[model samples]
Target: MAGVYDFTAKSLAGEDMALKRFEGQVLLIANTASACGFTPQYRGLEALHQALGPRGFSVLGFPCNQFGGQEPGDAKQIEEFCASNYAITFPMFAKIDVNGNNAHPLFNYLTNQKYGLLGRSIKWNFTKFLVDRSGKVVARHAPTAKPEALFREIEALL
Candidate 1:
């Protein structure tokens, strides 16, 4: 029963934040990178966030550098790039691991609840976890899965 609501994580600003705050909202929690091909997915994610945020949907971005050092910039640089390019206004968290012993607790719990097509371990950057209103991990979207493909699932949960 250790779900997403049972965890806390650092924000992009480095403040501790309880995941419980997002307990009753539909969420698209993604592990992101600044220099990867899927980096452009931020636009789509922002689009989704803007379109559905008022309806209780959110896209939470977590910057990760584990895959080929794609998100190596400091938080400032990451912010500049995201804001300047995609105009993303959703929540963005500090850089963290998505797999292995040091993976972020929320992500560890998420991948445990919903494994990917290849398996449980995260394969690359931009992997997304969809969480329902009750803090349950509802689905896992791969790197190639566009943000638009997630609308139906999000709508169902909303």
Candidate 2:
């Protein structure tokens, strides 16, 4: 079976990022937006990255505009917004679709590994997928699931 490491995504800077680089690290992969109700979650996500990054844990943010066009920004805008507003230091990917036929491959794999409450399709922005050190999908968190709520699961993986 293919693992999370098998995927590669474009960074906000337009560089191809191989997920294999994060092998053996616990990951919190989240679909993010800039102008949504859950946009404030970026702060908590950054907090988690800052607090746990030294321990082989990291948060990967992927900007998605599929929901209400909340993240309707180009790479530069998204990057600047994240940096200035939330001081997001973790890696943020280029904008991409998180649902429908054009969904990114990584998200497609994620949904297949762990479906949401209603179904596999991501319900909204900020939906999170917790991946263990071995690249296994450990849990799927809803958009409303606070980043702090993931501490225990991340600690167990670490």
Candidate 3:
């Protein structure tokens, strides 16, 4: 019964972060890209973080370049883009593969917990997973699913 808390990943700042630190908090875990059509969703995700963060909610963004090579920047570049463009205050992690053999362990666990419309592999960037306070994958949101659409579910978990 491995939960999300059982994982660890490197942050955009290059620090090892244990997912257990987020235990008991509702999480919106999204695989992000800087140059995609859905890149603008960062703003909405920031808004969600601002609105619900104090109520035990957090949005964790993981930059992924697997899709169209849209996120081909290094960690520093990604951090600067997110800060300058979206003023994103939420946590963003290092770039990692979201599919294929070299996928990050956290993502591997996530997809195993809940499949997307296209099946086990993530169809595109910005694919989101909503995790409850107990670290269970509660819902899987497609890349097209707007950040605002997750408010009700987040509120319920809060």
The C-alpha stretches of model 3 lying farther than 4 A from their native spots are: none
If scored against the real structure, what TM-score would every candidate get? Answer: 0.96, 0.98, 0.98
Candidate 1 error regions (>4 Å): none
Across 1-158, the per-residue lDDT of candidate 3 in tens digits comes to: 77899989999989999989999999999999999999999988999999999999999999999999999999999999999999999999999998999999999999999998878999999999999999989999999999998899889999
Measured over all alpha carbons after superposition, the RMSD of each candidate to the real structure, in angstroms, is 0.9, 0.6, 0.6
Per-model CA lDDT versus the true structure: 0.90, 0.95, 0.95
Q: Per-residue alpha-carbon lDDT of model 1 for 59-151, expressed as tens digits? A: 999999999999989888998899998898998988999989999888888888998876789989999999888887878989999998888
28-125, model 2: which lDDT tens digit per residue?
A: 99999999999999999999999999999999999999999999889999999998999999999999998899999999999999999879999999
Weakest ten-residue segment in model 2 by summed lDDT: 148-157
* Clash count (model 1, backbone only): 0
